[model samples]
Target: MSSSIEDRLRDAMAARAQAVQDEGPPPPLPLPRRSFLVLHARWTAPIAVAAAIVTLVAGVAVAVRDGVPQRPVAVAPAAALTPPFYVAAIVTDHTVVSKTVTATTSTRAPLGVYDSRTGRRTAELPVLVDSQVAGLGDGRTFFLAGRERKDAPLRFHRITLTPDGKIGGMFALPRRDDLRTETLDALAASPDGLKLAYSVNTRKPGRKGEVRVLDVVAEKVRRWHTDRPGFVDEVTWAGNARTLVFSWQRVEQEIGRETRLLDTSAASRDLLSAKPVTGRTTFFAARPGGSSFLTQEGGGKGIPPLVEFSTTTGQPLRRRIMREWFSPQAFDSSGRVLLGIVRGGGLARLDGERLTLIEMPELPQGERVYLETVW
Candidate 1:
């Protein structure tokens, strides 16, 4: 390594040691290597140059059930019926999950549920010490996962909403002995909430290349071994419950990646189709609630806009370039509209061919709000 990089590394290590001395050994970082699960919203931020993205969008007034006027989330092509979604913003103080926090802010993660129809913060549900959240279809409840301590096995928890729309209860998901529990590399819940898919951290050499799909109702788990010499990166359920989409990268071979669209209906299971890519190795982040997924182009070099492609065939469908690469967060219940947030820009909605302005909550001075979304 160069002298400058070496110095930077040395300084970072020293700082880390100092932090450990100050705080007790921290919990295993809950790094869901780009969680794209159904209604999955990240409370964490990405490492990138803090480029300010100025979002300017025209608007229209639409009325919701309350008859309240709200700025439109998206302006569809003429007569296009856009799907609606509920925006969930998980506001927190922790910048990095792996590190310890000073515990100055609210102890619980505050979840703000916004009505897309009215563009209003309908309810705020306070959850466990969660850094991310996945929207459950019930429109109120959600899933929370955590690693409370350094050696704490990664586990899933459910956050059920009360009749009044408050965070009524939180419960741990039953633990499985067959699965590795140290890290949660990725997590995806089936649309129907019957199946849960997740992979432990396998980025390390010699770790088995695999992923597990849990049958929530049956309480049984099925394992999918990625082609040997390769590991799974991300997983998502296609529009239908029986189909699954995942990222598989070869570690020992050509050193490239491909998106696997697998159908899990047959006894032996069938690899329906592997989405083909042209230029470079890119992992696909499937948008929740649909067959469409997002992938970065430009060969993993400069930042690339998340491109939307069809799962049946790896064909580009739709995507709106932001001031830069816009992260795809959620899709509407109908899998029609896509909601994305930028590093510095506020929320954006992808309609027919344009990005319409959505609700941007004003943050306290010097405060930043992190958002997660679901339909």
Candidate 2:
């Protein structure tokens, strides 16, 4: 081989090796205004490209260059009440297993603990299947929801993580039949972490399912059942552990119309009443520190144009069209700290009225990502 050709090959390998390293440390790269504009067309966004992120609420912007997030500019210090802690799930593409090099370092964990204000990745936790994990919030223990195998009954284990992201310890709760093999939304916990609410299948062929709550203090389980045979939507704790809310839909004769994946209808019911709250929606998510909730536009699958609901009442607050798709992910107790992912993809923090996108450098093709609030 010619010496010139050999030199060229060596340089190419060095550049490829350098690309995988984390950029300059400390404050994260902010999304810029120009880059933010591109995400407005997220539905048609090209995979494997750096996303130009915009966070107007916090006055920050991040620019993605060569599939790398670069040129971060801080608009101002984040709000005082904003959530400082959160857990993030990075969904890499399935096909990349053989294409990229796997690192044994801390930043590459599928599950990561991040500081919202500083954009610092504080700890790297176990790399469990995204479907096998149920977020219990930052300071509280998380549920490693899983089963031994496809034939085995579902298992829910409460595991605590230390500051360094090591599993401090884990305990298995009594196995339940209702927990799905991979659906984390099937389980929920109250803000106080004193109670858990879940929906399980019924043995009788003609009966509706049961929504059960386990009180940690008393170590007693309480059960609530629907009048007819139906499926429960999501079981959410309405702040403070004082009220538990859920939605149920009766089984329809037509399986094609009522399929779980396609169903978007919602009928919210609180523990206080048999009737669902009039005009309740499945998109509403309970705020972390309180019973308040936040919702995106419409139901099922579509672009969420705006976020709605009063911070105080958790009721419909206002609706305004968004230039880009922003989906609410998590909120802290103060009801002040809010996290939302762009409708197209990636993470963004809601600053008062403006939004700042968190630039993710390494996204595998066709990756699926979700955020867990860490307050």
Candidate 3:
């Protein structure tokens, strides 16, 4: 009976080996030495036969196990996207000469890294004056949009800081001459640090304003223009990366100001192609995947309520915490945490229902608090 089973198994293995030409190659296996087997044929013969059957069975079991598909392992949800550190605003005091007033105004604004929990500054960057700042969700990478004059072309600098907020390195992005002629009202960096969405608000009479997305590494640009005369600013990207949440207001009146959603994947070039999310939003941020929006509505009295609303149904989900003079800046990667300005004071963080006030670096005397900060 054993001899018959061994013969059958050998024949089956030969047939199976022939059928395996479709797969690349079989795994290399050791062959038994014939001389040792012959010397101990009586005792070793039966043992070798049993061992051969066991080896074949084990190989078959292994092949069956590897061939079967496995159910995917369930991954745990990610922790809250609140970053511990932030790249505060670039501090610069500029003087405005108008017909009504001419005075040298100076205010020392916070221009470095700061702790989100304790509200203390962690590190400082060199003076990058007259520049706007944007950040990737990672908390260390940032981009500075700078120009020499109002009409000068804008140059983008990519900055990376160490985990401790110390300067790592800096480099310039590809320069685009076309951006120089237009005014950059808003600039937002994608979470992946590969793309940028900016609004060009040209105050010209008839010409339309523009929204542009630049592929940083590829040096390619995609543009969408406003159909009518309106300004589109405060552009923020949904976690999806392709959806943008921006504030749009007509050039004639600010009454009908609306927060709208733009799908960059759309084929349309007109800015009006964007869908309306909410209206009367003082400042706004969108959650990842464009599923909801958080807006600051009503500020005539005390602190305006930071309300979260469903984008699909346009219904209020819930209201969040707010500090005095809290100006909604941007949302963290998870879209749950918010970073905002606290008037002439320090930074404000809203995580869930809890609001935390972070202290900025002390300003020198005679310096006003003009903060344009980022994470």
lDDT of 1 by residue, 148-186 (tens): 554545556666665444556877778643333334555
For residues 1-375, what per-residue lDDT tens digits would candidate 3 score against the true structure?
Answer: 488886786677556655542333333344447985566466645456556555554444444445662333334434354576777654456677899987775554445777666656767665533455788755777887767676667678888877666778888887564555566778888777788888887757854678888888888889888678888767877666777778787777747577777888889988887887643577776665557767787545777777776655556788755656566777776566788876665677777556677655555443454556678
lDDT at 94, model 2 = 38
| Residue pairs in collision within model 3 | 106-367, 107-367, 107-368, 108-367, 153-180
Q: What is candidate 2's lDDT per residue for 240-293, written digit by digit as tens?
A: 565555556566542311111100112443322343343334344566655345
Q: Which numbered prediction scores highest in lDDT against the true structure? A: 3
Write down the lDDT of every candidate, Cα atoms only.
0.54, 0.51, 0.68
The 10-residue segment with the lowest total lDDT in model 3: 69-78
Instruction: Give the Å error, residue 96, model 3.
Output: 9.0
RMSD of each: 25.8, 20.2, 11.5
- List ranges where model 2 is wrong by over 4 Å: 1-136, 139-141, 149-156, 171-185, 201-209, 227-229, 249-273, 280-282, 288-291, 299-323, 359-361, 367-375
Arranged by TM-score, best first = 3, 1, 2
Candidate 1, which segments miss by more than 4 Å at Cα?
1-132, 137-139, 147-154, 162-165, 169-181, 203-209, 227-231, 249-257, 266-291, 294-308, 315-325, 343-345, 357-375
Mark the 10 consecutive residues where model 2 has the least summed lDDT: 256-265
Best by TM-score: 3
Query: Residue 207, candidate 1: how far off, in angstroms?
Result: 4.2
